[model samples]
Structure formats: structure tokens, C-alpha cells
Target: MDRQFSDRVEAGRVLAAHLEHLKDRSDLLVLGLPRGGVPVAKEVASALGAPLDVLVVRKLGAPGQPELAIGAIASGGVQVLSRDLIEQLHVSASRLATEIEKQLKELDRRERQYRGDRPFPDLEGKTLLVIDDGLATGSTMEAAVRALRQHEPRAIIVAVPVAPSHVSSSLLSAADEFIAVERPQSFMAVGQFYRRFDQTSDEEVREILAAHTHSGE
Candidate 1:
């Protein structure tokens, strides 16, 4: 049977339930991928009594297929590329460079928008819970985990509401832990499992982070 969620909020609540065992840990912090992931991460942060923040990442799409991720770049100049996919698609060296440069501009724009002058928290020896609304290609989260590793975190746990079982297995080796509320056998898109799959806005992301910050202090 397919499991459907009413919305991201509901998905977050359900995801949080699975994370209850890790609650109240002194070194825990939640980092949400902006736009869609913040709301879901907010709930988990609340459940675990952990501080929340944003980790901006930009997908480097194939030249013509904007929806197809060739790779991704993260806030700290960290990038993860799919060499096999790039070669299969015949993406030229120059073309890949052009695409990466374009996405890096957008990545910087988002980093400033969400973070202002605030520095990323010290993540060394911290148990970081990185949340996203869900995974499709998993490139974005992979970039995030690799970037986060530079900070020497004790562990990186990638959590999501839904993902295909194969996609879930592919990302396992990248993180210390991976958790999802639903890993269905048959999956199309992440939105298909939700009743309300609206695009999350920048203002909403800001509000969620602001609210959590105020409450935490």
C-alpha cells in the first residue's frame, strides 16, 4: 500500500516520530535545505529540541534538461558530479563549466538571502540532521553531505519524508545514517505521495527559521 501525506507539515510530524529516540542531545542541530525543506526540518528540530538553520545548495541541471540534475553545488564551494551521467549525456567540458558557473551564482544569491551575515554554525563533532522535503535524484543531498563533511562533523544523517527504495539505497554510503518515513517500491515523484504539494516560498522559509531562532533563544 502507498502511504500518502496530507502535506509537508504532516510529513514532518511523522518523520519526527522516528527521530524521538535521539531527542535532547547536546550536540544535535538541524540544517534544512531552503524553500521546501525548512518546514519539515522545523518540526524535527522542535521534537529534538535542537537548533535549526539553512544549508543552501543548487542543482546543476543538464544543459537542455533543466529538471535532470547532472550534479549539484553547495554553500561551501563543494560540488558532487555524476561522471557517468555526464558522459552518457555527452555534456562537454566547456558545457559543464558553463553550467556550474551559472548554478554557483544562484547558490551565492540564496546563501545571502537566507543567511545574511550569520556564519554557518561550527559543525565539528556535532550530530547534524540534514533534512529535505524528499529525494528524487538525490544529487542535491549528496552535494550537501560532502560539503558538510569538510567541517568535520561527527556524523551526518540525511532524513526525508519519501523516496524510492533504489534511490534510498544509493545514498546510504554517503551519510552516517539515512532515514525516511516512506521508501515505497513504486515511486514517481515526491509530490505524488502528498495531498498538497505546493511549492514552498522563500518568505515561508525565512519565517520558519526566524520563528525557530526566537523560540530557541
Candidate 2:
């Protein structure tokens, strides 16, 4: 063990340990921000005995640096871009629009692949727990919260394994409750805390959802 845990499974176990209090909420729903968030959320849902679903979100990456998100787009055509980053990088409207269109296509493809004819669960008057592997710029998470708010969830709880303190602070108003196990002061990448931070595939996401749904039934 090189300090960090072995994988998302271990991370989820640790995450579940701290969330024992939520195990008994009657109307609780755990929604993972796929595709990386699904694995971790699976563990949390399993431990908490809560129904699990996914919230689709895509990062609008700056040209030449796909990992550097200039903004993020979520389901239902919701987007949140950093104005400062856009002005600083001199990103043009045409470029941002192009990126958003590209990511929206991706988001649609993923939604179709993962969901098929399965309907999204009703969020009205339900306690929603949004799970992600970690939080970085918080743009994607913010977009997700904004999108989810339209559905009128009783409350929105953001749960993650790791995040910077400032990012967590910024999300405090967006989410009804924020829970992060580690708020590292010197965080640079979300992968730093994971021993096996591998890319998650669409098939895996579907399989996890199917298996959990069947098992729960």
C-alpha cells in the first residue's frame, strides 16, 4: 500500500464508514456522476441499502487539454462555465459552443447506452445523494446540482471521497449537505488519492446498474 487505498472499492468502503448515519433514511436515493463515480457509488449504495442511479455530466475541455475543464455540461442541457477561465484563456464563444455541442453529443450517447428505456427516478420530495469519485474545480458538480434542482429534490447531498477545501466551500450553497472524507491542502489531481484510478467504460456502468437493480429487487 503506497499510502492510498487499492481502488474505488476500498475508497467506497471508507466512504461508507463515515456515512453510517444515512443508512436509515426512508426516501434516500444515491445518484452517481458517471462513469468514474459509478463504482464508488455502487459501494455506498450497497452499504447504505439505497437505490442507485446516475447523473450524466460531461466536461467541456479546453482545446489541446481535454483534462482541463473550461466548463461542464450536465443532463437536461444544463451547463456552467467559468467566466474567469474563459476570459483568461481568451476562449471564443464559437469555441465554447463547439465544445458544448461535442460534449452534449457524448452525454446523449452515454445516457442512451447506460439507461436505454429505463426511466429516471422521480426526484420530487426525495432526498438525493450525489456521489462522485472526487471534486476538483467543482464546475461539473455545480452543473449537476443546478440541473437536479429543477426536479425539486427534498434535499441535495454531495458525497465524495476527496476534494480541496475551497472547492468544498464553494459547493456548500449548491448542495444541502457536503461530505468529503479528505480535503487535501496540496491537491492537484483527483487521481492522486487513488491507487487504481482507471477509466470506467460504458459497459461497466450498465452492468453495475443492472446488477444492483436486480439484486435489490
Candidate 3:
């Protein structure tokens, strides 16, 4: 049976339930990949009673196919690329460089926009829950996990609302643990499982973070 969520909120709640054992852990911190991930992470953070923050990641889309991610870059100058995909796609060196530069700029912009002058939260020795709406190719989420590893967190749990079974399994090695609300066999896209999978705006991301930040303070 295919599981469908009314929206990210409902999906997040379902995902949070699976994480019940980790509820209220002192060292737990939740980081959502904006802007879609923020809403889902907000619900998870609320359900778990953990502080919430954003982890900005930009997909390094392939040449001539901007929606297809050949790699991804995250905060702290961390990047993960699929060389096999790039080679197969025959992405030119100059074009690849251009894509990286563009995404890096966007990544920096998002980090500043969502966070303003606030410094990124310290995660040393903490157990981080990194949330996203879903995973299609899993490149972006993989980049996020690799980047967060540099901060030396005790563990990283990658959680999402929906993803292909294989895609979720592939990320298992990147993250300490992986959680997904649904892994349907017929999955073609993340939005297919949601009744309302709207694009999350920058304003929405800021508002969610502001609410969490103030509540944390």
C-alpha cells in the first residue's frame, strides 16, 4: 500500500513518530535543509522538543539540465560530486566550473538570508537530526551529511518524508542513521506522495527559523 501525506506537516509528524526513542535527548539538534525542509523539520523539532536550525545546501545541477543534480555543496566549503554521472553526462570542465560557482553563490546567499548575521550553531559532539522533504537522487542530502561530519558531531540521522528505497539505503553509509516515513515501490518523484507539495519560499523559511530561534532563546 502506498502512503500519502496531506502535506509536509502531516508527513513530518509521521516521521517524528518513528523517532520516538530519541525524544528529548539533551544532545539532539535538528537541522533542516531549506527551504522545503524547514517546514518538515519544524514539526519534527517541535515533536522531539529539540532546537531547530537550517543547513543550506545547493544542488550542482548538470549542464543543460538545471534540475538534475550532478553534485551538491553545503556550508563550510564541503562538496560531494558524482564523477560517474558527470562523465556520463559529458559535462564540460568550464561549464561545470560555472555551475559550481553559481551554486556556491546561492548557497552563501541562502545561509546569510535565513540566518542573517547569526553564526551557525555549534554541533561538536551533538547528535544531529538532518531533515529534508524527500530525496530523489539523494545528492543534496549526501552533501549535507558529509558537510556536517566536519563539525565532528557524535552522530547524524538523516530523516525525510519520502524517498525511493535504494536512494535511502545509499545514504545509510553517509549518515549514522536514516529514517523515512514512506518508501513506496512505485515512487517516481517526491511530490507524487504528497497531496500538497508546494514550493517553500524564502519568507517561509525565515519565518519558521525565527519562530524556532525565539522559542529556543
| Preferred candidate (lDDT higher): 1 or 3 | 3
RMSD to the true structure for each prediction, in A, is 2.2, 3.0, 2.3
Best by lDDT: 3
In order, the Cα lDDT scores of the candidates are 0.87, 0.86, 0.88
* lDDT for position 209 in model 1: 82
From the highest TM-score down, the ranking of the candidates is 1, 3, 2
> Which pairs of residues collide in candidate 1?
none
User: Candidate 2 — which residues are off by over 4 angstroms?
Assistant: 1-3, 59-72, 76-100
* Candidate 1: segments with Cα more than 4 A from true spot: 65-70, 81-94
Model 2 Cα lDDT, one tens digit per residue, 105-204: 9988988888777877888899999998888888788778877887888999999998887897778988999998888888788898897999988999
Model 2: how far is 194 from its true place, Å?
Answer: 1.4
Q: CA shift at 113, candidate 2, in angstroms?
A: 1.2
lDDT of 3 by residue, 1-217 (tens): 7878899999889889988888999999999998888999999999999999999988888878888888888866678778999999999899989999998899889988898888888889999999999988887888788778878999999999888888866799899999887777777888888899999999999989999889972
Better of 1 and 2 by TM-score: 1
